[model samples]
Structures are given as C-alpha cells and as structure tokens.
Target: MSSTPDDSTAVIRKTALNAVHRKLGAKMVDFNGWDMPVEYPAGLIAEHLAVRSGVGIFDVSHMGDIRVSGRQALPAVQHITMNDASKLQLGQCQYSAMLYPQGTFVDDVIVHRFGENDFFFVINAGTREKDIAWVRENTRSFDCKVEHLSDDFTQIAIQGPRGVDVLQKLTDADLSKVKFYWFTRGTVCGLQDILIARTGYTAEDGFEIYVPTDTATSERVWNEVLAAGKEFGVLPCGLGARNTLRLEGKLALYGHEISDSITVWEAGLDRWLKMDKAEFIGRRSLERQQTDGVTRTLVGLEMIERGIGRDGYKVLDENGKQIGQVTSGSYAPFLKKNIDLAYVPLSHAKVDAVVGVEIRGNAVKAKVVPTPFYKRPKRS
Candidate 1:
C-alpha cells in the first residue's frame, strides 16, 4: 500500500527485495518510513494495466504479521477485532479492524484462522509498532500468547487474471481448490510449508504468498514468478500501482479513509462492525453511536469538471461552503476518470447529488456516485 509521510527519522527500513527492485530500475521513495519502490521502469499506468489484464507481482514484505495462539486465542481475537472471529473455520481469513474503545480504528486487518487456538493477523505496515503495542496492551489478560512475527516472512502478491496460472507452474498443489478469502499451506517453489492465501487488494483474482524473509529465497521466488509469468507480460509492480488499484476497487487506506477519529459507521463498514458480537473492544461505543446515528458518512464522488481532486481537498456545497474533506482522491487509470472518497452529510450523499470539491481554490463540479468505480467482471 502507498502511504503518506509519518516519520521524519533518518533511518529507513528496506524489504529483502529492495535490491532487486533497485536493479530493475524501480523508482524508490520514502513511503511512511520504508525505502520502497513507488514505480518501476514500466511506470504506474502500465503496471496497473498488467495486473488488470494479465498478472503483476509485488514485493509487499513491509506488511506486519502477528501470531495469536493458546487455548483462549479465539476469545482474545474476538476481544480486539470488530468482526466475529468465531465464525471463521480452518483456512479462512476475514477482513476486520482493531478499534479503540471509542469505536475508532486502530488499523484495518486481515485475520486468518490457522487452527482452533491459532490465528494470524496481517496488519498495515505504517502502524506496525503501534498495532503490536495495542494488541499486547489489550490482550494481556487473555490466556493466549501473542507473538510478533513481522520480520519472519517476505510476503508477495501475484495479482490479476493470470495470477493463478503463473503460480500453478511452481507447485503441484491445486491452486483452484483455494477459494477466495481462504488459504492453503504447502510447498511452493521447492520450499516447504508456504502459505498461499487467495486474497488481494485488487478487485481481480490473485494470491498472496508467504515465504522466508531471507533475501536469497525472496529474490529467487520473485524472479521465478516473473519468469513463470513471462508469457503473460507480468510486471513487477510498485506501491504507486498498488494505491490506484485499491482505490478503484473502493478499498480503504488507514490515515485517509479511516483513522482513530473515524468510527466504523462513519467509514461505512457496518457489515464488518459486528455489533451483535459479544463484548469486543469497541462494541459498546459502536452500539451507542448506532443508536444516536452518525452525522457524516463516507461517500464516493466523481469529478464532472476537469481537475483531479487530490487528498485533503475541501468538499464544498453549492454556495461554496466547506462541508467535508476528501479522504482519498486520484485519477482512476482503469476507469479513465477522476474520483474521490469523502466524508459528507447524509443529506448530500444521495446518488447523483451535485457537490463541489475545492481543487486549487476553485469549486470543481462533482457528483455523488456508486463506489468501486471499477469492478471486475464475474468469471463463468
């Protein structure tokens, strides 16, 4: 995921594939605090199209992982996350969020159930330290053990239509059997006990593979994946393409769409908020907010005027009054238009409602539209 600057320290972390990305002429930037590739020689638009049309590989090792286990693991996970982890069976993963007591976000996460007492959390890179500390502080009373395994794995994502085909060449394991949101552990590229999850940020078919953090192993698998998908025109994608793909898919980013100040209801993630679940971290606050009702809401906007509405731009009403702010905005490469997600009052959120976004001191014409501006066609 692409990120905004948060830390100003001179020290910057790099993934194991950092050398490889540099060798491939990827333009590296200080993303949050990591020295990460923002775009490759192929550029952002081409890399985005590669994933939508065929396949593209991304070195997403900067993401953090946590292991929760022991007899009380399920209860511990349920206590921290908004989603009900008890519903997850083996090999299943669900999108969830760890929230504050006041019902705001700690970070959005993917919780995977490895066993009855074993679960893993894939957390946002930018909040690694903060999230780890939050989980530890919150779950200290539970009988489960929380292990920080952020440095143990180099996570890679092979996304787009031909992603499965590229991966199938390296392993005999039936990639077809791994349903969406589920995962399987088996040998991949001669390495044992690799975890391949059928999950991706892109609204296209893909898989996220977990391999050792060692540079040699990481690079070998990375090169093999590119070689395997050579016939399909695979591109080594970077964070620039990653951001646009998720935005077009209507996915949320941490500081942008969600934050400690933004409640689940405000972000419109009511389905996963799981208010019915017993006594999670934010349940009480969420219930109270649900009863009182939320004032502002997350809404999608499309520019009817020429300018691209960038992040932090003021959302305005017809009289040029500031009503809300653009959380995330960009030119949708796939959809071929400018779009944004913003927090606006319910009165201004109806479909086709005319609104104005302040772009460069001018009120640019925009309208409320259905989100996920680009959804992949269903496969037969």
Candidate 2:
C-alpha cells in the first residue's frame, strides 16, 4: 500500500465523478484506497428498490481497465485465463478468472474482445495494481503487450430497464443490436470514438460506458447522462446501493466471495471455467479438486427468522455446531427479507436445509435458498 503525504492518516483517491457524487449529497467512505460514495439521500434501500423497478447510474471508475493488444492477444489471454478465448469473436466479452500456478484464484476478470488483435479487461478495484502486475509477469513469455489503462479511462454504469433508453438519447449508436457480453465503438454525449459494453454488475438491462480522461468530455457526459435520464427515473447511485443491487443479483465480490486463497470450482463458478481449452494456471489442482469433490461450496441463504446476517457471521447447525460463514449479506429491499451468500459444506447446501446464523451472539434461523434472490421480468 502507498503512504499518504501526511503519513498520519490514510489518503483516498477521488474519481473524476467525485464532484457529481458529492453534489448529490452522497455518503462517502474509504473503499480500498479510494474515496467512494456509499449511498445517497435516497438511502440504500430506496436505491435498491428503484433499480429493481426503474433505472440508476453508478460511478465505477475505480474499477481497473487494462488493454491487451498485439498479434498474440487471443493466445496470450487464453494462456492466463481459465476460459477459452478462441471462441470469442470481435465485440464479444467473457467472464473469467485468473489463477496462480497452483489454481487458487487471483482475481475474476471480464475480457472484452474489441478486435482480433485488441481486447479489454475490467478487473476488481481492490486488486487493480496487483492484477496488472500479475498479468505483466505471466505475459512475459508470450509475445503480447499489456498496458494498464486505468488512469486513462473512467467507467459509468447505467443499469436497469431504462438504461438503453437513456443511453440512446445521448449516443447515435443502435443499442438494441449490442447483445449481452458484446461491445461497440460509438459516440456518447458527443464524444466521438469510445467503447461501450453491454455489461453491468446488477442483473438487469444495462450498459457500461468507458470514457477517456479529458476534463470537458467527462463533465459533459456525466451531466448529460443524468439530464437525459430524468424521465426514466434514473437515480445517481452509490456503492451502498451498488452492493445491495449486486447482492440481489448474486454477483460475486472479488475479496468477499472469491479471493487468492479460493478456487473457482469451490465458488460455484465451474460453468465459467473451460478446462478443455488446453490448459491455464491452476488447472491441475482445480481438476483434482473436481474429481475428489469439493468440501465447501458457495450458496444463497434466506433468513427464516429476524436479523440480517452480515459478513464474518458464522453459520451453525440446529445442534449449534459451526458449519460455515457468511461472505456477504444484507436486507434485500426487493425480497423484503434478509438474504446472504455463504460458504458451507456441500452436504448442508441443499435448498430448504435448515441453518442458523450467529448474529449479535444469538442464533437466527435461516434456510438454504436458490441464488439470485431477484430477477427482472424478461422483456418481450
């Protein structure tokens, strides 16, 4: 970690959209090394409900953006990732995990295929610098170039039912054709030649726009997005609402749900791992774990009793035996109940299985439930 100039207190970096967030009266907090907005006057619960019902915008500029461009782009990425990059066509994006040589997770990343020789990766904020360093070390053998572009670009996610509607008003691109996990170069808010990806943390219709760092352009795009989204009920959301929204969607958090000590198979992400694609870091260990059967698994839990199960809370059996621990939890505004994701033995992860969470030294009843506590209605 880098030290601050004062050396007495921690210094948090502010984003290009920090002014906008503060102007909206957002509750700011130290997230990792960044000063981020956690919530707004609308509150976490209200913002969660609004996204489930309407639309919202989030400043995710803190997330790291890296560009990998060279003749060996595909093979270079495939060598480091667990997913098969050969099948990825231009404009397609795939979620993947980077593993150590031993197969333990380093970080889960999203790769966007811009062209045959160019690609983009969006990595977790907490692991930004570490992830870049890992990529550079691993790609040393491959004939590829990886550049950390986090400082050059900023990201904004417009999520929910009306995301496209508001984006279309600002951009000339035909958004309907940009399917899920795909991207295109287009003009947004009069900024020509920018990349837009149809992706988001919230499990809803949305788009994540990458804006280059330029004072005039960033300011104009940020303000125009909010202005155009007025009729769509677009709310400027913070990390608090962002967390709740992702929790309801069952999206994995890097440090919480997954970390350098865990493997993807144990995290319920085997479907995203492509073992048949030759080989990748940690393949042998993960393959061994798969054959031996994983001991612990990540699953969703619903509180059958009162109290919200928070991170670090222990899960116990009916007989008061410690079974597992909650990784992330909250009072889901859409479900109107407490929901959480926990790591427990596979034997106790069945749906409807009884469990108890230790909250404030008291045992609260809970039950194993299907993940993705809420899903948006499919548009016809």
lDDT value for model 2: 0.85
**lDDT at position 106, candidate 2:** 86
* Model 1 misplaced stretches (Cα beyond 4 Å): 1-10
Q: State the C-alpha lDDT per candidate.
A: 0.92, 0.85
Error of 2 at 40 (Å): 1.4
Tens digit of lDDT per residue, candidate 1, span 246-339? Answer: 9999899999999999999999998887777889998889989999999999999999999999999999999999999999999988888999
Worst 10 residues of 1 by lDDT: 1-10
Across 37-130, the per-residue lDDT of candidate 2 in tens digits comes to 9998988888777677788889898888788889888778888888887789998999988898767788889999888978789998888878
Candidate 1 matches the true fold with a TM-score of 0.97
Per-model clash counts, in order, read 0, 1
